[model samples]
Target: MGTSLNIDLTAPGARQLPKRTHVQYAALCFRIREGKVKVLLITSRGRQRWTLPKGWPMAGLSPARAAAREAWEEAGVRGEVLETCVGGFTYTKRTSPHPHMALVYQLEVVSQEKKFPERGERKQRWVSPKRAAELVEHPQLARLLREFHPHLRKH
Candidate 1:
């Protein structure tokens, strides 16, 4: 319980830094098209790796809500955040120089932005989930997309 109390804030080495699991909200952003599930993937700004919309936790917002906000900023789409998330995955956060555990949620996209933030810096595309799985670099995230059912939501 007191492990965190021993962490040194100014530690430069990752080994010296407390082993903490950073959190992020990832939108497994998708849409229904002609009775099929179409997943939206965006190109990462630096390496241009195909990936989902994700961001650090926002103030006063839940994980799913932050996922929605990230969708708007990164993919230029607005969506509905479902209470149920597919699962979580991990990736090394470039900015932080450490791995982050990302909670992935399904978002039903409803609208797109014409001139939103990060425009022209990244490319967004809509493709079949299987195709998206093949395109994305994250293994766990790819598996999640490949296994996600189009009819997941129950009404």
Candidate 2:
């Protein structure tokens, strides 16, 4: 996803902030149980920090499809991916100086496999959306999780 900035050039010493040079697509995997939203969060491979399943764009997949693929690969999540992006956030990894923006799509999870690509490499858990927000480090992503609501129309 592309973002546009509205800068005021007339302001004294005004300058444009650097755009996010790296982009990733992510899946906010969730399911409703007992009338409550349960979110699935996975730990990062290197940092062990909780986060959504995300990755760089794939050559031929659409953004939502790529996000779905990441969810499956990273967390064994198989679901219905909504093309409507819930939100996006920018952050810089501890290992790199470049800022990365992640476009997030909501995935209403159908099932989770017993084994998947990253199953042994990372930890996964199911928590409330608020708890999911608390477990993640990025404030913007946290906010997105906190504010997330299921689509009223059935899938």
Find the candidate with the highest lDDT and give its number: 2
TM-score of 2: 0.85
Per-residue lDDT over 1-155 for candidate 1, one digit per residue giving the tens place of the 0 to 100 score: 00011224477763442377687888888788898889999998988999998988999988789999989998889867775556767888577776687788788888888788988989999999899999988898888888876434444
Instruction: lDDT for model 2, please.
Output: 0.86
**RMSD in Å for all candidates:** 8.0, 4.9
Q: Give Cα-based local distance difference scores for all models.
A: 0.79, 0.86
